[model samples]
Target: MSEVPAYLREGYITPDELFRKIPKPSEERLRARPVAVPECPQEIPCAPCREICPTNAISMPTPNDLPVVDYEKCIGCSLCVQICPGLAFFMVHYVGDKARITMPHELLPLPERGEEVVLLNRIGEPVGKGKVLTVVPREKTKGDTPIIIVEVPIELAWDVRAIKVVRE
Candidate 1:
């Protein structure tokens, strides 16, 4: 029998599994500008990410279909990031040697812009350190889910999905 998907087995999609299930943004796309990267691997009934996209970049043939992002049409706006009910959408933008990752932030004591944070991967494992670049307040988002942008090494961009704010 075919093996169970890693997302089902491990409760989170591993990088390898994610790349296998969805097309990774082309290198040319990554260097162009910020783009929405949906990590939703499950075929469950969900479509807010696609519905709320202002650029019509995210598309799903049906409610249960996995999201497909048209990188070229994406404007890199964080609307998808803020609207996704599962918090599966992210924005990746490379600037020189560093990359900015914009993701939904629901944790308490939100990190301020320029604050240092511990970057975490899909399974909540610490991957590296990064700095908060921007925090879109909840008042601006559709569901009141705040969004934050953290800058990390370009190499860690794809792996850094969440952050842990260390309070002094």
Candidate 2:
């Protein structure tokens, strides 16, 4: 952890900074329901996530501060995910042995439900395979961004942020 992460060096919020901005969720909360994880660690003048949260879970003290989420108030809704301009918000729900990640997808061709897709990390590098659980169409999102829900190994819940559809 000595070397600075790309997010930090690139002027984005670091993992350590994000961790301190929001309270840590308990295992029970993480395992029981979906929580919105804001990967937007930058101090940009953004507040859509805070404004759209129905449960008032996301908050920003000032215009340029990073958004913070109160996991206890988050109702697992993907409103923030769909409305994010930076596409940094993700909904994570942990099941028995797997984790369901709901992420924004703006690709040309979307994957189908039950289709196998390549899991990707923050930098778009292929990490593993995941199964598509659901695909929320663009018409359903506030910002016209479609959302894809994929199921992957529990260990990948934190690492996997995006997906790559392997077409023939």
Q: What is the TM-score of each candidate against the true structure?
A: 0.95, 0.90
Candidate 2, residue 32: Cα displacement in angstroms equals 1.1
Q: Which stretches of candidate 1 lie over 4 Å from their true place?
A: none
Worst lDDT 10-window in candidate 1: 6-15
Residues 59-107 of candidate 2 have per-residue lDDT tens digits of: 8898699788888899998899999989899888889999999999988
Distance from true location, Cα of 21 in model 1, Å: 1.5
What is the TM-score (0 to 1) of candidate 2? 0.90
Candidate 1 Cα deviation (angstroms), residue 103: 0.5
Query: Residue 168 of model 1: what lDDT?
Result: 73
Return the clash pairs for model 1, or none. none
lDDT of each: 0.88, 0.86
Q: In lDDT terms, how accurate is model 2? A: 0.86
| Model 1: residue 104 alpha-carbon error in angstroms | 0.6
Q: What is candidate 1's lDDT per residue for 59-132, written digit by digit as tens? A: 89999999989889999877888888898888898889999999998988889999999999877889889999
